[model samples]
Target chain A: MLGLSQQALLRLPWRRSLESIALPVIALTAALIIFGGFCAMAGANPFQVYGSIYKAAFGRWSAWQHTLILSAPLMLTALCTALPARLGLVIIGNEGALVMGGLAAMATGLGLGITLPPLMVQLAMAAAGMAAGGLWIMLAGALRYYRGVNETISSLLLNYIAIAIMNHLVEGPMRDASFVIKPSSAELDPANWLGAIPGSRIHFGLLYGLVVCLLAYVLIQRTPFGFAARIVGGNIRAARIAGLPVGKLTLAICFLGGSAAGLAGMVEVAAVQKRINQSLVSNYGYAGILVAFVSRHNPLATILAAILLGGILASGGILQRSHNLPDATVLVFQGIVFLCVLYSESLYGKFPCFREGEG
Target chain B: MAAESLGLWGIPLGILAGTLRGSAPFLFVSLGECLTEKSGKINLGLEGVLLMGAMSAYGVSYLSQDLVGDFWAPWLGVLAAGFSGMALGTIHGWVAQQPRVNDVATGIAMITLGSGLAFFFGKPFIQPQAPQLMTFDWGAWSSSPQVQAALKVSPLFLLGVAIAPLLYAFFRSTRWGLSIRAVGDSPQAARAMGISIFKVRLFSIMAGSFLAGIGGACLSLYYPGVWTERISSGQGLMAVALVIFAQWNPIQCLWASLLFGGAQAIGPTFQSVGIDSYYYLFNAAPYILTLIIMIITCSPQRTLSGSPGALGKSDHT
Candidate 1:
């Protein structure tokens, strides 16, 4: 009887997983249809617009390079939300952590001057960024665990505060004298700049993102700690009864997630911007939330979702130039996708095929 | 030396003026959120709603000025903003009621949708000059031109102030208000009492959204007096935090909003007095204040008595 019940449970999840995948796919298709209607209302043929988007984002070698570059940061930041989500915490202050991480990295680079070896300086910058980001997000976790503060609200408010702090530093005390037009820190020495891949325009950050996400996938799916975290997420009261270290797990997961986001900021500074400035606080943090949600908080799936979103963002300029549409037009598409995906959550477990004894 | 002292005194006076002017948007948004939360749903998407409202209000004011002249344009623009907010709120309410929909995630999506639609449609209105709402020169009694300029108050500001006590009375005395509170505190109990949870919550959300839209209109049609992509600047989000700080009391919201307004005014006030040091830090005061407030009020040891029991929780039934 035990073996039979176990077999039945195993069979049910396979069908359940199939439905989970099918529902989101359907939602995405519906969202695309709605987006197409909007485009048609704007006087552009929806098919032509989608075709141009595809051509611009993935059709050419140069386009692929751009998408890969954008995806690198997104993958890292998406982890920020995904990991915390495993503990049933919604942390959206990845932007704040990214900004602070970038600032910390920049400060470390400038503070070290040129005394250390180039590799050492780069390592130090990464460390600074990770530490800053980890602490910043950990504050939200701590607040939630200890103070009953809502992680979502606290983290988001922290984003505003972090940006303000960055602005204060960049525009005031840390302003580089020669960089008058835009207040920025002194650029990192050329020796410290992250090198691009030999055959492509994409840098080492893409590899870093993939490796980190893979490691995260392994940790979440294959570890005892992850098992405990899942238990906590499934039911906190039960987790307490089980004697699980819920507080410690929450803080550790939040820290790890925040460190990934911080590293993304460092990569943006070292590999792309080559300096820290106001531009570092781009919407990658917010976009990562969408990516995480689309991936259903799975680290492995986050990589694919990040790349897809990166391609959409990469096509914005092309849409503007070719279709006379504003760059923000894509935001409408993303918003629709987000809504449909959230709505699709209702469709899960309701499908007839997934019903017990159907097979 | 006398002029310097006068300038010093102007800082306080300027802050007082800023409190009255700046608190209007905060007051309206917080009250709106307050009403919604009282019905057991938190609409964090009000940030995006405010942005869309601002954009639509500006666009309508600009268009109506061309068609009907300035006399009626601003009021018509306010109406358009409220309508836009209601539409978005309806989407949120409907989605929230759907099975398995997470209110927080849905709220986030709504934010993206509202802001995306606003930005996509607002491009044309960026350069147009919309008719601005009129303001009363209450400072005319002062001899200083500086004081007179500082004291210019929009009529919307007065309306926001008046609405606070009215909302307090609404919650205290009205049947609908009691119904909303009942739905919020105990949905099972409310349902047993023959109340329709869906209708009460949905109508409450729509009404709250209308108030938030008025707040957005105040931002574009009065103070800043121009439509820009950044007009709302997270004021709607800040108002969410403000509602918590107010402990869900409408009257307390007035005091909390003024405090936030004062925090916002610090930067400009200091600048006017030639104290440019740490200006950006001063600009960050409101966010800092919000963080501090959340820390103080959100203690796990004590339950927040004013919080609606059902707020932010999914109703499995």
Candidate 2:
């Protein structure tokens, strides 16, 4: 039998929340210190390097716009991992879904041509992209739920296959003869291109990302479906005993998550690249995994995490130019952050201060 | 085209040679992953480990060639690659063993860390040439020059083939192997038997990573013979899927790796036949095949009999 104080120490709700936030914050600081040491070793002043990173990422309006541009796709892609995570599925195939989505969007746009209104064409593109992305991830979920295949490995393998398919289409059938230097589909008409926000270079994808993330937050935190998904995630056996449609929930969550990533691809095609190409398979999908992890799989938190990561990405060129750091310096920082965040998991619920109710 | 240079007989022979050549990396990586998974751990970071090993091997080989005589440089490079892999694996094993750490997430982090470290360190080793591992022409018996050239097999490939049986035997017969199996099947049982689960898993992960490092060395020092960022191109990840396809049996790993190697060889074979239209499609075949195999093998009705019971689960102890 435990004493009263021991029981209290184990029951502190606020303490758990505090420790969750504190541990990550501490880990972030530690990672920065370690990375600063790395920069110093590379013959750059650590303070100046950090200063440049800050300035380039957030100092000027233009820099802010660039960061926002980078953040938009990340916000959407992070949902691919974050949402399915609620169902205890680790889907890393968002890259595959994103590329497939982009391909679908491009194909739809090409098929629709100028016959439709620009707004209607964009909607069709988004629908096609979402549907394609949803189906791709649903396949992985179906494999996991029906075939018992591990989603992580299958999704990753699917990513490679998706990239291969993208390469085949772009280099073979979809190649625009005029663009021999870089194989790509024909560009979208300027009228159909995603317009910039008023007085800013940032596009409407940023708004879409924010709205989707908010909607996802509401869906997860304020809905019965989200409650059922959480229960399934907590314990599949119990969820099954409780008569939850475990398979349907898994499939649905995966489809929704995948659709978010698909929308990101659509955004990339309609809003930024304006054409499908190999570059559509950028590290944004991978980076989104990092973002989702850093946010602890919270959809709302993912927006903030994406912005932070986006700024870091936008600052890469400046770090290379001013500090003589390698182009991959940001990658090293990201790696450090990821490692620290993972290590920090050990600190949760173990802090003395977080222990319940002595006072 | 290089394939055109070889005739009809060369296409089948080319695939055979390619199977031997390409399967080396897969065999080593899958074997390593098998060892790790058998110890109740999964190190998805092997992709990054592969890249880092490739870079380290290339860097060491180039440096040793400049410092020491060329004769011992390649061997030294392979050793360095193995050590580097062990070091990274050590970090992963330690971090993952810590309380509350998620193995999958930790692996993802390690992937970034290893690849980032490699890219940063590998910038300088891009241009300088490193001594390549020696190869023997097994097809020397053939009258054609193309046959002889196509059958130029690296000693590493032969070594990989030989290791499969030895590893299978080790898992079946050795005391340490039994302990690893015990740990993987049930940590609670292993602990009751007075085994230190931590030590077994750590050592298994390190040893597995060492083998994976050797696989990377094969890529850089023998087959591709270059230090580049894209040298691995998800071969390590492919190896992970292959391990599952092989049902975690080392002998099956050998066969599965060859199957994958054959899939990879299809492109070059088609090119030899003057059908280069779907080259990217051929390159994509291995991944598609892996997915298909996984789909067919994975069944929800029953747990995979070959899976280590505790694989990927964080040990409370």
Candidate 3:
């Protein structure tokens, strides 16, 4: 019995991976309990709320379809923070990047006016979107680099400005006269809209999002440039001592982050909405911050985080319908998850079984 | 034609009213943040505090108006808002104090939590007619009804104005104020002098949040006089930038708040005068102005002129 107990305390197999996965799981379970308790306090059955969330998020292929579509944008927007975070910059400007990208794509698609082939028009719009988004975030990076401004504040402020600009365009300059009820831009040519993947309800944007996540992983974890960025993130003074081109790296990474988010915006316009409107500035950008944090800024891990959040988001409608709960019920759940996850960081390295114990 | 005729006079009067009302929230939030930051911690979660304050104030006022009478209900609401803010503030301060926790990340999470709780509990308060606090008449000299209406000043605004100079004095002379300044400028030195960094930060953050809650009351119980999900509208978040513009000085915070309020007033002022053109553009003014101010104030050469040496250290860690 003594030997068995000593063995149990000594180490666990695949200790590092197990600890990481275990900690997050524990945190998530805590979040579930807390959220359940909150629901009960708010005059609902906790079990039923959980049951409905599970049913809405994963009960059938239809729910899966909804989650998949919602997660596509989340993946791209998550990169908006994930990349900048690698350089130790806390930027929350994903919303602005997405908004600008959508506006830019709308303008490009309208300007093309079916003159080009559908595929070519799509490519042009994507390019325009990525460029606009890249430049938008790059401006924040430039401010941080040149002007010593706090990137987080600047990026957040940019989101408001971006929304204001979007409102101006859709409500004034880009407003479709016929659609007087809603402030919205003119719709794009139907042929230019992105087609769905074969036999699936999901759009071509899913492929783009997956591809970009893979590319970001390789870029941040593999390339020399990424290595230098890591070095910069680890310590700016040390990076400067090692002679990394800090300014260029900062601008380039921010641009990439913005481009990814911008692409998500283009995807939404081309795949789902087909027109720019107030709905385009949904809180996906804000949610992306939580995703990036939950994933610990690992580009590949962002996919899982996005999907989880997307599942929570997809359930918001069903929750309101079936549970008589407010739509923000999901937001409350997400917030609890975020807090639990962040707080659980302190729990790491504390478990005797996970550590190489002295005993 | 009438609105066009009233354009010049009504525009300025309307802006004055908006500024007086708008400045109250900004004043409270910035002042609260100033106190927190002055004690060497930056609470990015003030937005959440602001929202929670707004929600609680509205709910309390709505629920208590019948029991406490309308005159006293709003005051009680303001008090409840402060306590609600302290609750969230306590969460932030406690959790952020844990080792290995990033203050910035925790703050972001706190925003989600604060706003989440507000929305969750505030759903009932929406559509209820809460008792609104009375505004003091400051336009007895004016004969125009519109002018008299526009000249009405919230008592909270005057109180905020009064607090600024008082805060400036507290920072200048008091023992606790000097200690707060000491902790902010150099925590190591403060530690050597036997100050408990945890207690000071936690209390300062709570006090700051207490004020932010009052700012929220200024929103729901006074100015707009309604409870809604969208009432705060980033005003809570914008106050952080305003504090930066104020350079950690309470007196400067007052002017900065007025300037920001003036910027916000532009859109509504224009709409009131029937010059609705570029309304969206004008609404964007406060954010744009904040960005511009941050650009001018922050520098690459050295630390900001009055920035606390220990400010934001936890975020990097």
Whose DockQ is greatest here? 1
Worst 10 residues of 2 chain B by lDDT: B1-10
Candidate 3 per-residue lDDT, tens place, B146-240, comes to 77766789999999999999999998999889889988888888889998888988989999999999999999988887889889888777877
| Candidate 1 collision pairs | none
Residue B263 shift from truth in candidate 3, angstroms: 1.1
True contacts kept of each: 0.74, 0.75, 0.65
Ranking of models by TM-score: 1, 2, 3
What's the CA error at residue A281 for candidate 3, in Å?
Answer: 1.5
Task: Show model 3 residue runs off by greater than 4 Å.
Answer: A1-13, A357-359, B1-5, B315-317
- Of the two candidates 1 and 2, the one with more favorable DockQ, higher being better, is 1
A1-359: candidate 3 lDDT, tens digit per residue: 99977776556556867888999899999999999998988788999998898888888888888888999999999999999999999888999999999999989999997999999999999999999999999999999999998888799889999999999988788999898768899999999999988878989998899999999999999999999999999999999999999999999999999999999999999998899999998878888888888888998889998988888988988877887888878878988898888888888888877775443
List model 2 lDDT by residue over A320-340, tens digit each. 888778887888888888888
| Candidate 3 chain B weakest ten by summed lDDT | B1-10
Cα lDDT of model 1 by residue, A1-359, tens digit:
99989988888878877887798889989998999999999999999998998887899999999999999999999998999999888888889988888888888888886889878998899899888888899999999999998888889888888988988887778878898879887888888887898999999989989999999999899999888888898899999999999999999999998989998888889899877788898888888887887788899999988998888889888878999998888888888888888888877887788775678
RMSD of 1: 2.1
Task: Give the DockQ ranking, best first.
Answer: 1, 2, 3
- Per-residue lDDT, model 3, residue A163, is 95
User: Evaluated with lDDT, which candidate comes out highest?
Assistant: 3
Report how closely model 2 matches the true complex, as a DockQ value.
Answer: 0.69
